[model samples]
Target: MREFPQISYAFAYGSGVFPQTDGSASRPAMSPHPNPPEAILKWQKGGGKMIDFIFATKFTQHFHSLNLNRHRDHYSFLGSFGSSIISHVQDDWGAGAYFNPYITVNGTLIKYGVVNFKTLLRDLSDWDTLYLAGRLHKPVKILTEDPNIRVANQRNLLAAVRCSLLLLPPTFTERQLYTTIASLSYQGDPRMSLGSENPNKVTNIITHQIRNFRMLYHDLIMSLPNVDYGEARALQQGWMEDLKLDRPMAQDMDPAFRGNMVRRLPKSFRQKLYFLYQRKFGISGREFEGMLEASADEDAKGGLKKPVGGPFDRRVAAETDLREMVLKCVNQTVKWPSATQSLKSALTAGPSRTLRYLKEKREKGRENALCDGTIVALLGDEGNESMDSSENTTEDG
Candidate 1:
């Protein structure tokens, strides 16, 4: 992939890179086949898994134009319209990404998405859309690295922690925290709600890759001023068991602190919050700007620099409608992008490929549902058996 033209940033993610076991229960059992040992080994290692990649280039049009000459088969009929048209479609729609799926490279199946580097930066720093930022919230294998992207992604990861903290209760298990963080991207995604995606997708990812999550977030979590582990545990594998938030942070009703958190959110999202807050509270634009300035005027020590305070900031922080406002902002940012990207994938992948992809996804979804049901039934039976044993012991007594 390093040989791929002008890819300033690239990464591989999904089950192919970070293997997950929970989905194995849902996967079909392999049928017996007569094959040479080497071929069988290769199939066992890589078959049926699609390695996913996202490539960000300096100029999307230039990259596509070059790619057109080199690998024209990667494009659908849309490729006939020329690189300029393809670039326009990619930049103007669907979270500013164009994906080409079901392509084979070096005898391995792969799917890659291309997006302009600038748009990728904006999404990371400003949360203009959670489309890519949400993906960064999870663990990934960074194939190509850009210094600027690394900084922006740090902000993205911190923002995810802050948002998850706000949504979570005072005392929560590590699982709860990670799940809330993971759920950020899927909040308004159509595939999740429409049942085309596996319901246990997030849980499975976290359950199998807790160490990966710790690697990504542990240090960032420690850096937070308001969050801490409930107990001092030995530094070993799986130490992220319990988390405790400061009393005020847990209640999250502190106007000043909450206001700071809201302000620190991505610029685009903060702007949306401003408009929503104004509409709900009937404040003027000037007043909102003043409150924003006050929130931003904080020192390295987290203390107010000037203390130009107002009730507006307090109201934004302590209002019961705060959670609703945040959700509305996220949905506004994610809902359209998620849907449009799905549509774009269909066009970019072509009819036969799109159908094959959807069929594979739906099959996984159905299998997950059945596996979940079986687990629930087994748990229920165990509960009944325990109750019956207790009753027999009491009678004997």
Candidate 2:
């Protein structure tokens, strides 16, 4: 094992304390202030310690918008001075000792090492200039001027530092760390202070932090053991599956209708449909259904019997309202003397399209029947004739 540094500092600030219990009164109760720099220094001198420098709460029992793990905790980083010194600078600037830092730990990286923060800051300053274009929020100078402000600012910084430590890697340079923390830190309301009003500056700061975080976390992930990767992947997959089920399909049609249309379809047909949709409309399941429904409706109203002409067009019609139209044609053919040949011809044209056309015809027939009872009576007559023929044949036999 590599020789780890003996003296290491970690920051804790904001609502950085644990709730006071009867048994742990002297053990350091939770405080509204961020973690104190002195406390962080002491913890570093003592040994490995897990401290909260930032304020976090369990707001909900489940994750809402994103498919984040519900059981996993969510945190909010607050910038405060005492906590900032501990978490960010690793020591009070006033302190005489030169605190050379090495590592940071937050959510992912447990124990990792890095160069110093100053060098990282220099590199990140350049990065900020290029990408941020002076939009990034600079640290407030007023906090440094007043003793009271310094303490308060330090506490907030500590909270931000605490979050960074938990989430960042040890090898991250100061610039990387600073950028990340600054991004995570909340810029005060502009109305409250003139300095806070720059939206572009605030956005730049947040963007830098986010970018730094992505870099650091990605490194941390790569450093983890293969087993951890497998576990994370499985967890992510499970979450995605849950989302897929919970989230409604875009189309408004009943689940039964969708199932009836495609559930038992052959693999070849399914693949063909999937590709055809992806190529033509660049859409998926429910969207494709909606498009088909709309297209069929338009075709019906426009009186365009073959709006989408081709094998696929026929298939589309068969799968939608057009099925009724094709069915009506089949019924009409069946009423004729050469029913068998006509039915064969219709089927040969394409069973799917034939089905859709029949479906459309049925709808139209219903509408016509509603307008003129004569059409209904004629349909009834056809039914009666078929029944009478069957009865006559049965009696003669």
Candidate 3:
């Protein structure tokens, strides 16, 4: 893409995208580890990490063939075969994302994933892998994008807001909404329990990119129906704790609410979700009761629990069934990256090197996370950058 504009979409995300600047974005959250003052934590993709980038094209095979020929060594042993093989594996075996790992650009360790425009749209619109969707949830500089794709992403943002609202309590603060949005990808990831990810990763992501999240979801917040979102229109530019969802909020998260949410999601997801329901609940044909049941966590009509933390603890929300369904889907999405990475590593470096590759990735994540979390500042060079479980690196395995 740097050489030509043949690709449909591309962008630079992570600390590598920007030159070294003051770490002020993260500095404010440095007071303490667990709870910080007015902390607008960085919610996704740690700073000074590997420069993560993704490219999507309408012509997958053609684009891959050209790029593979141009940078054969980047694909490890697989490039020697052909782009068709790589593309096949990426689509058939993986979650529609293929990466060229540890690529050296100006001595910088960078990795870029490639997926077709169709897969990108599906994943973005649906919360399938929540992979690319999770990354886009954070602020990333766009190198190139299609206008249609931009519109699709806006819909994705709206979906994010609505879904987060569904997952939240009857009354919530603006930070709660943003935090819920930030935690979407990590809700049920196996990696979160492994300590492979930083405990404060989500907090850091939202704190650092607070302004960006505000800009993205503010409109959706304003448009929410039947709720008291009027406080968002106050003198402040972003969401505030003053905002509250009325008692009717419980009714809003009904069967129709879930149907609307499903309709807005990508077709691929809708298909998979429907199949899951059919297989488990015998919900065949047009019956969507199973899906609605999954979306309707029990209402807070009983009584509001004492405030625990941001966005109301999952328990306090009283949506055990919905949360269970969420964990099932999110965990289902998290499983694919590991299998694909293992397959790719085995193909590239033989089965032996696969272990080494995974070991190295884990070590790098821990090492990078050890750096100061106070700011999403730029690293001096690529050598210092590392990718976290939040995005690019440390996703799984």
Candidate 4:
């Protein structure tokens, strides 16, 4: 007889293999096997873990026979549904096979596990990078449940990187991968919880990578046949115009003034200015102020006077000061390296004035509408109807 590995443990094959058993010995076998004891002995001597649960035994056989290989590097064998083979083997079989429970390494199940693990690690990593990289809380659950479903760390990281690239176009690069990991590691450290230490290393890395990618792939990105460089240029020009306006306003006004102005300014104006400065000129707040002062001087010298017969009537000094500062900054920071006046004029011309006009017009219209509505409400319906009838008749005649 060939000596098989010693079975320190035994797994009873359930009804799936043979007959059902009641607790009592007198109970008839649902399906009796001629050599039940022999079969058990054979499995025992072969170093198999004793599977007591019938469901477990059936599942294990079914899964094992199916030999499902769902993912690249992982396979799943069913051995007792929801049963732990390692524990059973260790308890029943003396140090037999490695007794290790191995899940499919890169299949759906493993991917799910990896995703879950990544999420767990993310909270343990740098959260600022996650946020700045445009990753929110949703992917965490998906990743936690499946990491190995795709490629190993490669696919998981790539997917996250792609998402970051797509949502926040300004800060996506290959270098971000290493930087993000490093940042996570640093922030996750328990030592530097307070003080002057910057926790934004991950953000910095991401920024650097984006810069590098832009520089390296400039031609390729620009060369894409379907790409609309014209639209992009227009967008760039629009942003330049905005930065030209804001840099000065932000510079000339004190924080209190800025806060007040910000509150007073319409949302559209504020957003436009922010995008222009941030995207086009990349002018710092300090630089923006310097530009404002220069513009103010120019305006005082009668170089760029306020337009005649305009609501240039209200807060002329404040608005003039604001515009001058912004134009000055744009002139200084966004001028072509060749110092071309045409480029400067193009950036500072019609659009800026148009933006101001539209904003003022809208505000005035809103105020007028509110005042008219209040007056009408105070007047009786008869008066309101009379006013409407007169307007309608005037139009009809």
Which candidate has the highest lDDT of all?
A: 1
lDDT of 4 by residue, 1-397 (tens): 0011111111111111111121122321221223334433332232221121100111332232233222212222322322354223312221111111122211100111011123223321222122111222111111011223212222223323222222222223334333433332233222224221234434433332333222222333333222222233423434422312211100222233233332222222223333344344566777655644432313665684432211111222234244443333223322222123222222222345334433533443332111100011111343234333321001111
Deviation in Å, model 4, residue 309 alpha carbon:
41
Better of 3 and 4 by TM-score: 3
Better of 1 and 4 by TM-score: 1
Provide the clash count, candidate 2: 60
Q: How accurate locally, in lDDT, is each candidate? A: 0.71, 0.27, 0.54, 0.26
Q: Order candidates by TM-score, high to low.
A: 1, 3, 4, 2
TM-scores of the candidates are 0.81, 0.15, 0.66, 0.16
lDDT of 2 by residue, 88-183 (tens): 321112111112111133211111212123322321222211111011123211100223322322323333333333334324433444454544
Each candidate's number of clashing pairs is 0, 60, 18, 31
lDDT of 3 by residue, 326-347 (tens): 4465566656754464466466
Candidate 4 stretches greater than 4 Å from native: 1-113, 116-185, 190-208, 212-397
Error of 1 at 270 (Å): 1.5
C-alpha RMSD (angstroms) for model 4 = 32.9
- Candidate that scores best on TM-score: 1
Q: lDDT rank, highest first?
A: 1, 3, 2, 4
For candidate 3, give the lDDT of residue 350.
Answer: 42
Residue pairs of candidate 1 with colliding backbone atoms: none
